[model samples]
Target: MAMGVHGRRGRGGRRAPMAEINVTPLVDVMLVLLIIFMVTAPLLATGVPVDLPQSRAAPLDQQAKPTQVSLDAQGRIFIDDAPVAEAALPQRLADLAAAPAPPEGRRVYLRADRSLDYGRVMRVMGELNRAGLNHVALVSTGEDQP
Candidate 1:
């Protein structure tokens, strides 16, 4: 019975500090951050607010960042979320076209409020075509999405 001063162990001394890392708390924090980002990511995608029409068409595959052109319910125009006067839109579009484009050419995304008249959307499209920005895609929400 070679008992130490504590009377429970042969080596009887202060226990060595644990070297293994506890990962439970780390995992918990990471999962919380991931969920927070997932919740806010969609909100940050576009700045200009518009009531998009719902469509059953599938989303397009994107290779590069496309230029966004948004038309609000009030018939205001915006390029990449920046407000542009209707008279200035053509010049802005032309400048965008003049910029070096990818091999597939520059792409434009048209996001118009569903409340807008069809002619308004077509006129915007027509302006884009005149500016040599023919690679235009109409932006819409999925039918199942809110």
Candidate 2:
């Protein structure tokens, strides 16, 4: 019976060792990362969430980085993530623009919430103009202006 058992455990009965890598777990991990990025992509767009009014304007491609000024729904102003007093905004921006070494283009991108009053937006623009940082780009999400 022992000899019979040994005979039964021959090369024919042996299975091949698995040398190939199972990619299912790797694929699963990659899919999980993809989902995480997809979910957080919009949130990572920029700080101070704003429902930007849409525009049919062509996309801008430029070499220089612009200074960002974002206005939230509550009318709070942020200059590159730093909150600024409305009155102090002009001087601060002007000083920042002229500091250390001036950038290639003194362009300023204004990100304003769609629900904000037009006058408020204009006022901010006026302030930006006062700062002498005149090249402005109005950021929008491409939704038609309602």
Give per-model CA RMSD: 13.9, 14.5
Name every residue pair that clashes in candidate 1: none
Q: Please, what are the lDDT tens digits per residue for candidate 2 over residues 1-146?
A: 35543333437787566569999999999999999999999888866755457566787887867788999999999999899988888888889667653456677889998889999999999888877778888988776544
Off by over 4 Å in 1: 1-52, 144-146
Number of backbone clashes in candidate 2: 0
Weakest lDDT window of 10 consecutive positions for candidate 1: 6-15
Q: Which digits, one per residue and each the tens of the lDDT, describe model 1 over residues 38-105?
A: 99998888766644577778778878889999999999999998999999999999999999999887
For model 2 the TM-score comes to 0.56
Per model, state how many residue pairs clash: 0, 0
Q: Residue 62 CA error for candidate 1 (Å)?
A: 1.9
Identify the leading candidate in terms of TM-score: 1
lDDT of 2 at 110: 94
TM-score of each: 0.60, 0.56
lDDT of each: 0.89, 0.82
Stretches > 4 Å off in candidate 2: 1-52, 100-104, 144-146
